[model samples]
Target: MAKAGNGNWFARHKVITAVAATVLFFGVIGAVSDGEPDTGDEAASADQDWQPDAENDDQSDEAEPAVAEEPTPEETEEPSDRDKTPKSPEPDVEREYLVVHIVDGDTLELGNGETVRLVGIDTPEVGECGFEESASRLRELVGGQAVTLGESDEDRDQYDRLLRYVDIGAMDAGYRLIRDGLATARYDSRDGYGRHPREDAYIAADRRSADITCAPPPEPKNFADTGGGGNCDPSYSPCVPLYPPDLDCADTGPVTVHGSDPHGLDADGDGQACGGD
Candidate 1:
């Protein structure tokens, strides 16, 4: 009976030991699984924090692209006004005509045989002080050249001449004459002819040309002193002492010539006093 009791005690002690070992094994497995979950959660949190930095880097790259594209609109608008400024003159649209003949310093005949009086300028007549010089300069400018005409307020003058502004190549003919001291700026107030488009420029040129001094007229020699026996009065006939001592063709009105041309004022000899028309 003593031996049996000892065996039962020993058996009971072994069973208790086995049950404790199983319990310890299950607890260790649970602890390991829970620690793995905690580690995974920490890793997930780290990944989440790192993702924001990557997204911020992408956003910064996108912001750089936006900044690079910002100047496109301004660059496109810069040429808008610069392109329109050069097209205002439209020189290609002007009409052109051939210059057939140079009537005088300020007048021309077109290829169509129409006479055109240059606007805003008056040159000396045939027998005037600077007539030959002015005519020769005008012929040198537009003779046989294609010219352009600009119209003014009046289309025609009382003498039926077409009034216009003549342009030879790139040059303004009347302005050139005025600048060269060959013409004066003038307008007909009685004929409703208005001031020219370039009147101010022509006046300024005339002012500059007026500085040239002209020689004074010679003292008139009487017909008797010139060995002529013709009875003539300077106020009535084409006599030696023309009303103005330096009487240009335009200034010499209609006068009767009895015997001789004492002043040699009749250039064309049309039986008229001063033939310069």
Candidate 2:
């Protein structure tokens, strides 16, 4: 430890040199930093007062407007009837016509002057059994009323009449006729004609039909018969059955020859009945 020499400034003034050295270190640091690029921490501190033109802080900070997705084809499409149950209307009748006239049990005349024949049924002739009953019934059903008509496999019959299944307010005319024994199911597949959609129903109705049997005439008893009172066919010499119902030679065998030959017992017009046999 030598004593301080006045000529050695650093040794004599240590406190003053220390302060100057600290100042010089900081000045050199500032000069070096200015010549090089600024570090991340220094740049961050410098940007503390910086502001963005938009309100967004980061890429994820922005919220986009919500959009609704369109529905798919399957979701927007209408429902199809593929899975629905098929319904069978009683007759599925479509066309309608006004009945201007009732011709017979199975025939009709339209307001338009067209003729229509009821399909799948046959009624008796004008003079045959039950003819009046059938024709009268038809008039009561559809006379001057509109009726629905359904086409069958057949279109027009040989008579130039439109063949169709007829219905009046849910009532089937042909079916009713067969059911009531007023008509028989005919001109269908059973008869070698076209098969109709209602053929099975018609056949079933025919089976349930009432059996129409025309009553036979009462056996006549002339006072001369010696058995009973007077009820006889005056046309015959012997006087046969009564006239409530007509009969041929088969009923009264070999009737006697007489005037008028009322029952036409004389087939050959020879005035003899049941005698030809």
Candidate 3:
């Protein structure tokens, strides 16, 4: 009661305020006694969302495959017929022809007057049995039809005739002639139908038909002229005329008679004319 009587007496009351401040600090230390770091601010900031780079998204899209394209018809073109067919290796035959004129057993003249001798084949004379048949067969095969021609080593023969082989389709005219026993296979320079497949048959038929089909030996027109039998034919007078009497006796024999040499038409030296011996 006496201290509260004057304000100067309160100046000495500092000890009481100090005791109260010390009690408050001891209470705050006891509340923070557990060890802990303050990280609540950073935890809230880390919860924000994150974003990737735009270049990384572009790289992922580029990893996918691209679309494919198809080819056109022009890129897969094939070969033509001309490329498949083989080219011919021979000289081409001249065109512009029609009828083939018969020259002999083995020769023919085109409509243009060009003579062509059959190649790789030989036929009998005109008087032979199969000669006319051969000519007729050739005419039937190539008289008015077009044909492919193949030449021999010799362009022109000594007789000034062209030597050639004729082909109709795939058939060889020469081989057909030989197969039918109408001609003999002759391998001079070129090979047609290869070396005579039916040679034996042709040869046998040729020998069998020899007597009747072949040309007969020329008979002595005047045996007196050839030194042979003349009295046998009494109707014909036996004249002692010299050989080569300058008379043509083509009617007497089956073949033509001509003096090919100088010896009075006696080629064998038999003291005869054409057919004495």
**RMSD list, candidates in order:** 11.4, 12.6, 13.5
Query: Each model's TM-score?
Result: 0.53, 0.49, 0.41
Alpha carbon lDDT at 15, candidate 3: 65
Candidate 1 lDDT at 124 equals 90
- For model 2, how does the per-residue alpha-carbon lDDT over 120-216 read when each residue is reduced to its tens digit? 9999988778888899988888888989888899889888999988897779988988888999989889799978999999999899878556767
Q: How does residue 126 of candidate 3 score in lDDT?
A: 69
Cα distance off (Å), candidate 3, residue 95: 3.9
Select the stronger candidate by lDDT from 1 and 2: 2
Q: After superposition, which runs of candidate 1 have C-alpha atoms over 4 Å from their true positions?
A: 29-37, 40-62, 65-96, 125-128, 150-164, 185-214, 222-277
- Candidate closest to the true structure, highest TM-score: 1
Which candidate has the top score in lDDT?
Answer: 2
lDDT of candidate 3 over 23-137, digit per residue (tens): 9888788778644555775776665543356866787779977667677887876879988899889885454345457766578887667788876668878666777788888
How does candidate 2 fare on TM-score?
0.49
The per-model lDDT (C-alpha) reads 0.74, 0.79, 0.59
- Candidate 1 lDDT over 107-138, as tens digits, reads 98999888999998899988678887888898
List of clashing residue pairs for candidate 2: none
Off by over 4 Å in 3: 1-96, 187-236, 239-277
